[model samples]
Target: MTPITEVEGRRLALSNLQKVLYPATGFTKGEVLHYYATVADALLPHLRDRALSFLRYPDGPDGQVFFAKNVPPGTPEWVTTARVPRSDGPARMVVVQDLASLVWAANLVTEFHTPQWVVQEPEIADRLVLDLDPGAPATVVECCEVAVWLRERLAADGIEAYPKTSGSKGLHLLAAVRGASSERVTEYAKRLAVEAEEAMPGLVVHRMTRSLRPGKVFVDWSQNAARKTTAAPYTLRARAEPAVSAPVTWDEVARCRSADPLAFLAADIAPRLQDHGDLLAPVLDADRAGSVP
Candidate 1:
């Protein structure tokens, strides 16, 4: 029988601690929990008050996976949850507000921690997200180039944007907004994507069509929608290698053009946090101003 691990005074029944989740790196479930716990101080701030959708892999990265919207039944009452309204109906979503909750979620093998753009309210969006996904042969290098272009454009409009590695072969740029309506943000993002595509002809694709993707980076503006969720920064991706959705500086983003796409991994996050702190911290500053108004 697996013994319960005590973290921050919380007794969690952790199982398969030695089970390798990332076969390539031989990263175990215990390591995953440790990573979350070590980074909780920086990570929980981003997740606080946000509705989280869990992508669980019970049997590690090689096994079948499922996403849990509503906190699974039998969740401890001490763990926080928020009632969020969806198209079909209102669903209760887990809100990771503390270290205990974060560790608990990690115990569930929640590899991808996706959170809504809005906070507690479903209508208000606090940030604008731009997901730059490169199709085959395009590579993250193209995504980096496109991101720099977008960042400069936003800067010209007096907006400050934060960039991060998507933990996979993509990049995510986010900017703090004044709790704007999701529809407004979505429209604004779509228009910006179109404008970017126009500015860089062969480099950017605004639409979601797959065939149009090859050799082009897809500017996924659709992530701004109210129902849409993006992988929270610092969350580990469910890949053969334990890569994390690490927040990066603009300088790092620029350098990534010539570096490996998987440069940032689970092992790299702690050292980064120690050296640079949270690069995305400004995204949570409610008073910070910058938008395409």
Candidate 2:
């Protein structure tokens, strides 16, 4: 029988604890639970009041994976949700506001993704993001270079940016911005991408056309759109190994040149939190958010 554990007054039946979720690394469901529970303090702030788009891999990362928008069937009553209108119709998405809900979702082996805005302000963006993705022949090392340029460019615009590993390839540069509509941020991000392409030429590509991607870093600026979502920081990705979308320091982003930098795994987050206490913490402060200009 699966054991039932009480977390913050919620009785969660965390099943399949011994089941491996990352076949290559033998990481189990139990480890996933532990990682979320351990990173809760640093992770929850980024997720609270934000509607989630979960990617569930019930059969492990190597097996079938499905996207979950509405709350999973049988979600507990205490779990928070936001009913937002979609192009098709109204949709209810889970808001993993606390430790209990997070663990419950992790129990289902989910990879968390959230939009740039919060539930309270759906169409307005609180953050701007640029996903610096590299095509083959170019690795995250190339992404690091582009991120540094983008960071400086953003800073000149008075927006402070933070870096994180995409947990797959490349880097993500995010900055908290004040009172801008999703369209505004999206357009601003696109302008930056285009500017970077102009500045770097062969080193960067702004458009998503597949043929133009190779040997260049594609500055994906569309994650700022109201409907688009980004992987929540500290969330595990469904990969062959248990890689995480972990935050990094500017120092790490600046000096990262093939020194095998910015790669973080599930087991690496707890210690990182202890040392840095969430490098992205400033990005969570709405009051301190800079203008999108």
Candidate 3:
């Protein structure tokens, strides 16, 4: 067994994560590294004290790697490992079967992907997206500032919200809730977006249309249905240095340009998943209950 350092462990884990990720997403070989790094950084933190593992798809055929959960004797494979399917393709996915297998798993498949569009779970969600160019000439500080404001308001509503770096110059705030229809969810989302824009005036923009929202934050509410799309968690984006849809706390979102939710990696992601684990849970409930009517 290779003695592992923290850095080595992360590398191994990421390599393993790639196997299921590659062919599923059809990511080209060149896009793998950034995708892996982004997901590794965001998800690693939450993986503590758990039996965790990953698979990777490096290049060419036979590039798939797999890991069995690094657990004590007698643990079940099904209990310790899981396969997360990529929304892009039904059969395509990244497998994180266990921990020690990290090193061997990085060899399968190829390509890195960023969502031009992404599909999310079925259900309505109350979402507030702060869209902006993190790499623009403007300061990331300004972007973070807006996130702080959004976080505060959402928190006040007793919403259990999660943040994701948009893999671009923006951030997404996903709130899980119940008892809301799609229409109500969309209305609530618009209300929140409008309110945020009103609160900051020029600091944030809520216009969803590209032509209208040239250089401002647009509170996107479109990710609110069964087939609707949002950036996939940990999926590598199409950028030069790809960014994943990393989870973040309000504090981190409020403070950093890129707050890596490295703590919430796959090993821990399962535990965090609620009954209707996806963000749309609450809104779906509302709609089903006729909240919109």
Residue 62 miss distance in model 2 (angstroms)? 0.7
> Model 3: per-residue lDDT, tens digit, 61-150?
344333322232433233323332334543222233333322222223222221211123223333323343332343445556766676
Ranking by lDDT: 2, 1, 3
Q: Which window of ten consecutive residues has the lowest lDDT sum in model 1?
A: 111-120
Which candidate ranks first by TM-score, i.e. highest? 2
Candidate 1, residues 47-140, lDDT tens digits: the string is 8888888888877778988888888887878888888878789888888888888988888988555544545568877788999999978888
lDDT per residue (tens digit) for residues 109-146 in model 2: 89999899989889899989999899999899899999
lDDT of 2 at 113: 96
Lowest-scoring 10 consecutive residues by lDDT in candidate 2? Answer: 253-262
For each candidate, give its TM-score against the true structure.
0.96, 0.98, 0.48
RMSD of 2: 0.9
What stretches of model 1 exceed 4 Å from their correct place? 116-119, 259-262
Q: Rate the local accuracy (lDDT) of all candidates.
A: 0.84, 0.91, 0.43
TM-score of structure candidate 3: 0.48
Which of the two candidates, 1 or 3, achieves a greater TM-score against the reference? Answer: 1
